[model samples]
Target: MSALLDQPLLWLVVTLGAYRLGLWLRDRTGAHPLAQPVLVAIVLVATLVVLTDVDYASYADDTALITFVLGPATVALAVPLHRQLARLRGFVLPLLTAVTAGAVVSVTAAVGLVRLLGGDELLARSMAPKATTTPVAIAVSDTLGGLPPLTAAVTITAGILGAVAGPSVLSLLRIHDHRARGLAVGSASHGIGTGRMIVDHPVEGAFSGLAMGLTALATSLVAPLLVALML
Candidate 1:
């Protein structure tokens, strides 16, 4: 049984099954923000792996194919951009400015506070790229001399929090524009937030996807520069 569970494809099967279960649970709850599919899936998967006595290293290695797919998945977002090119171009300057400013501020505040709190340089850099998506954050963290795994974890947390709270905050601020909402969520939360925005409205989804792409590009170029300037 243990050997069977340790098969190369076992983790992939378990992952897809757990995610489906998570999606079902989320739908049953009317897709409450707190019941995020990935979050639910993570909990279920973690619990099952512990019960089955599978080591984290083996599980991670088996599931690493999903990371490779993120590249093609991200590239697919360009479809929406192509369809909405005219509208997207009109907002390019403003959106670029927003993403750039947000990236700088996010890195600055995170690194500054961590250093102020007497945290080590490693800890500061780990948290610096929290606002970016997992892949981008991992790359930025590596360039900044931080741990890729730790940056991924922190980036996930930031995405989850942005997805869960972003809409409510936008409502509180009376920012009802779809473009504004999408940009805010994507710039702050990354792909996870964009997923949540898609379920709300098509326009919001498009803008959110654009914001995510722009944010990834801008942050990739800016993160190392920001680190050099500050450190």
Candidate 2:
């Protein structure tokens, strides 16, 4: 048991096993909000960490195998985008415009609000990419001299908030087009909102996927230059 605990591979297996168990439990519970797999995995892993007195670095080392799949998972989103190429072609201009505008607003508003509240410059910089995906957000935060950890926290928060409130917000404004809805949610919220989009409107799922990739690419190109000019 001690030897198993000591091996990084064992730890990796345990963490993933726990996450899968959490997912199973979530599904069996009929997808209860409180039983969210991500939330459960976090609690379970945190408890294990505390009990074992294991540091994050050690846990991360063990779990790097799983983390390494993130890139491939992101790329796999392209399959859906490709499947929906005909739909994509029809709204190319509007999609691009919405994504660009939404990206700019999300970054600017987050950073500006944080700065107004007397947040540190690094915090402000981190806020600039809080609306995008982890890889892009981290890169943007690093380039802008922000704290990556804080950026990650903020990005997750932004995604959750966007997912929770997005549909209602759009409905209140009477914005009913699936394409527009998908673009807005994905540009502002990334994966989490995309998940919610899939549940509500499958057509939106394709556009959301496309928006996520395009927004990441666009933001990656523009955020650094904007930060440089502003700073």
Question: Tell me, what's the RMSD of every candidate?
Answer: 1.7, 2.5
User: What are the TM-scores, per candidate, against the unseen true structure?
Assistant: 0.92, 0.85
lDDT of 2 by residue, 1-231 (tens): 566577868778777877788668867986544454555666788798888888788888889987899789777777766776887666788878888887777767777788788887787888888878977898888988899998888887777677767877998999998888888888888887786677667778778878888888888877777667665
Cα lDDT of all candidates, in order?
0.85, 0.78
Compute the lDDT of residue 188 as modeled in candidate 1. Answer: 86
Q: Which model scores highest in TM-score? A: 1
In the predicted model 2, the residue pairs found to clash are none
Cα shift from native, residue 150, model 1 (Å)? 0.8
lDDT of 1 by residue, 27-88 (tens): 89987888777877788898989899898899989999987898898778667656666776
The C-alpha local distance difference test score for the whole of candidate 2 amounts to: 0.78
Clash count, predicted structure 2: 0
